[model samples]
Target: MTTLAPTEPLPRFAVFGAGAVGSYYGAMLARAGVPVVLIGRPAHVQAMRAHGLRLQTADFDERIAVHADTDAAAVAGADVVLVCVKSGDTEAAGAALHPHLGPQTAVLSLQNGVDNAERLARVLGRPVVPVVVYVAAGLEGPGHVRHHGRGDLVLAPFPQAARVQAALARAGVPTTVSDAVPQALWTKLVVNCAFNALSAITARPYGWLWAQAGVPEMLRQVVRECVAVAAADGIALDAAALDADVERIAHSMATQMSSTARDLLRGHPTEVDHLNGHVVARAHAHGLQAPVNHALQTLVHLLEQGRGA
Candidate 1:
């Protein structure tokens, strides 16, 4: 539980899987004068290396210069590593980072799915903090990240949680260290289970989906199913609060499409298997039924298979 002194230098950050989410945060930190290195795809790395990362938001559009590389070895001297890869790549990302991480490097899982931190920790044989990310962003091109709305993070308490929070705060990234992180993660999971598949299946945004006939009720059913599964797994979720958050998302990010929707549109594999599919599996493991979640998961799988489109 060590803390950074006020006179201490800023921690160096390395963002692995520098896609939309990673690029956004790394750009923010780099804009604030913190040293950041983004390790990502060759196209993105080349673009960033040549022109820098272009961060487009409602407030500003600017290209922030930051170190960019396609090699995992770029993480060697980083003090903090943010893992933002898709859930399917969590293990591989960890394995790739294993040899590069220094003894004092703190790893944070900024991806979706509650089990990612646990899985990554097992892979790295070190404690990995789990962060619940709430942001609406997408990649417009190789080096460009378009911010739709809201960029905040909720993290479970750990030894380096305060330090990480402090670094992000300096970069103007809103962050919280919450004792109820498991509950928060479950709440976020419930929202994803409710909206991601529906948005992807319909290729619609949150406001439109919520405005559709019976969509609100369907969302409720999905949330209820997720709550039951979470309760069985010993996490109590406030359904009313979750519903309120769903409404907030609908209003605030009305124009933003779910990441799954974007993925399907790009002909890329969606993380539906980690979102709704995870719920369905957990429900089954608990001898419970989550029909709505199962149906959504099935539909998304079909779409992924190029059947439903």
Candidate 2:
């Protein structure tokens, strides 16, 4: 029996680089009766193929029946491709998918960094929707994801956005398709700039940082600089409410380690260049100063260099 959405046939999805974020969303879509194929690593594919995808959220725990693969060729018939690799892997991931994607496939960049969509479009010679992911989940193990809280997405408007948003919302993924997505992406970038490096450098969570003296003020400076860069890029961020939003985010996710922190912990290269380093690069391009971001980027670079030493 073919299941149809309210107005259209549910789109087949292929989650590229299905790590924590990709696997979780794929699981959600599968649970909603949308066909999805998770293209991830060998271990994940093996586990999922054996036992299904184990998804544990705050509200529920279940194994979803979905397809899993380790090849980019698995995306052949997929209507949508969700890119979920790290910021540094955007170009390579795009290259891997270049020969596989259909002309009409809707590519969505679900990773961090505000410029990812633009980068991907350049690499693939096609448009890619930029998505701001507001989710707290991690790969607990192979083929397993433990969701802590918040599973929502804000996406740049595209021609197929209406159908996509309807499917996502029906699948319990809160979504908003808007024109303000550029600013929204910058806003999330601002948050990442403020916390990711510091967290990686200190090897601590937000609570530990909040417990430190002067850390809050330092973070404030970081956000202020990122906002300036965003303004220079013509984003016009909500300057008045920016501080409150950062504070709320820090306190709310106090126990969570920034993704950079996790990468450094695992001795993998962190996305410092894309986060704080990105602000510094753009600031220099505009002849603006971003000393705080520079310092953070430098420190993270040192950590990267010292890894395995």
CA lDDT of each candidate? 0.91, 0.90
Task: Put down candidate 2 lDDT per residue, 3-28, tens digits, no spaces.
Answer: 24566788889999899999999999
> For candidate 1, lDDT tens digit of each residue in 224-302?
9999999999999888888888888888778878999989998888898888888889989999999999999999988
Candidate 2 segments exceeding 4 Å error: 1-7
Highest-lDDT candidate:
1
Give each model a TM-score: 0.95, 0.96
